[model samples]
Target: MIREEVKIISKEYLNKDVLKIRFEKPKEFQYKPGQFINIKFEQEGSFRMRAYSILNTPSEETLDICLKIIPNGLASESFKEAKENDKYTIIGPFGYFQLNENEKEHVFISTGTGVVPFINIIKEFVKKDYKMTLIAGYKKQENIICHEELKKIEQENKNFVYKPTITREEWGGLKGRVQKHLPENLSKKMFYICGLKEFVIETKESLLEKGVNEKYIKVERYN
Candidate 1:
């Protein structure tokens, strides 16, 4: 693992609160699709850090991270004050989430910015023969991130399916929490669930109750 200070390339807002920040990749940095980097920042009179999943594909030249800014959060303050050309100290590309090696369809369930890791993984999986399904939940239709890009990927790739659901607002696509309307044949496919603790726990429990094997499900909590 390498601790390096990298310069911010650019910053963009995916919606009203989500930030998609990119940094110039270090020359020797290497990590898998489902990994994250620990970002170091100065908070108050001391240093603090936050873990943000790598958002871009592994083959990309730059590292990207998408996160929702919780108002007055520790990392949120640093993210809010960040600008292009600012230097960010990053350490490690750490995570244990792995795609199942066996022949099974890939199912991803996530809410808000928890979809970050899957976004990175899907970019790698789409090139393979795996049949992938992504169900992303948001509070409203407008809060959806990577909307056009994911839709384009869905249209172009026959092996991939994208569903963007909403809870607090009416939408043309799917509606409700991720666990409320899960895809069919849950037992046969491998599951990856991410989001707040409740979201992860509820979805995992739902899958377990449906007879999906414990080994077939992987989960990550954002909050």
Candidate 2:
């Protein structure tokens, strides 16, 4: 991959742990919603690269990557200390998790930082006026990143529905794994799910159990 220099335009904590880092790339840098970019970082003996989803929409000039700061991982640790105006090498907007225009209703299910891709997708929906339903789950209430943003989107677009589920907390909304809320009537919609391996597998199973066609389900697994 040809590495390109992208400048860090801003950095903010979406949650206490999840960080959203916006970067400015060349004007022509373009990619689909669910695709990701390979981030290049320094290493002593070998090169270190990590794939992060492009969390910015076409309407936005600057590119962005929503990163979760791991306790001791090299990439996460480096990003934790990365300052504004710093430039880093980013290669490609890879992967095939992007949704198509023909797919009218999107059922996006994600856990933890896996919700990053859907954030971009929902942004596009708002810009182009499409319909989408988001179901995201986390371990606890405070751990839920992008809580306020999701609520705002839900309020802004009538077609946009946000359902936040928690595994360990009692909440007014759905209070279990996201699978518990998978719509029974899914014959006409497309599904995109992103999470860890187990979470993705279980979510796929739940969708299948509810009669969602296998072809309509797309998954992106992280670690």
Candidate 3:
């Protein structure tokens, strides 16, 4: 793997624990919308690495990544303490979670930070005429990240739809797990899902039982 050093351009706390960070894209770096990069930093005389999906489109000059800080996690602590212009080593353009490029209806389902890759995919690949739906699930209202951006995309493209759901809090919008909100007919739609392992397994099983072909569904799971 080729390692490149990138400078942090900016970092902002989106919510209580989630952070949105931007880095200077290396001149030689080339990646697909849904690919991820591994960031390495030194902590206690040792190197710690964590993989995060890129959230910016290829047309953008910078690389963006969103991560939820885990208490006591070396990588999370390092990110939390990062300041602008801080340099770190990055390796990759990894993962196969990308748009299929076929002209077909698409449904994207995600929870928490799992929505990172979809942001780039929609902005970079989904054309205005492409049919797409995003169903995102969060635990509470304050935890809903990137709703404004998603809404902007929805307003700009008539073919795209955004639906956000809350499971642990009362919400005026959709309420319940994303798996329960799956469209009735999956005949012509391709499904892309990302979330916790249990959620992924349950959703995939539900899709399989509903007669959706395995090849038509792509999934990525986080711990």
- Using TM-score as the measure, which candidate wins? 1
Runs off by more than 4 Å, candidate 2: 127-129
C-alpha TM-scores of all predictions: 0.97, 0.93, 0.96
Per-residue alpha-carbon lDDT of model 3 for 1-223, expressed as tens digits? 4589999999998899899999999987899988899999998799988889999998899989999999988989899999999999999988898888775788999999999898888887557456888899999989988889999988988888888999998978999999878887789888999888988898899999999999999998876
Please report how far candidate 3 places residue 170 from its true position, in Å: 1.1
Q: Candidate 1 or 2, higher TM-score?
A: 1
Off by over 4 Å in 1: none
lDDT value, residue 193 of candidate 2: 92
- TM-score attained by model 3: 0.96
Q: Is candidate 2 or candidate 3 better by TM-score?
A: 3
- Per-residue lDDT of 17-85 in model 2, one digit per residue for the tens? 889999987777778888899999875566789999888786788888888888998889889989999
lDDT for model 3, on a 0 to 1 scale? 0.89
lDDT of 2 at 54: 81
Q: Cα-based RMSD of the predictions, in order?
A: 1.0, 1.7, 1.3
Q: Model 1: per-residue lDDT, tens digit, 111-197? A: 999888998888888878899999999999989989898999889999999988999988688888877767777767999998889
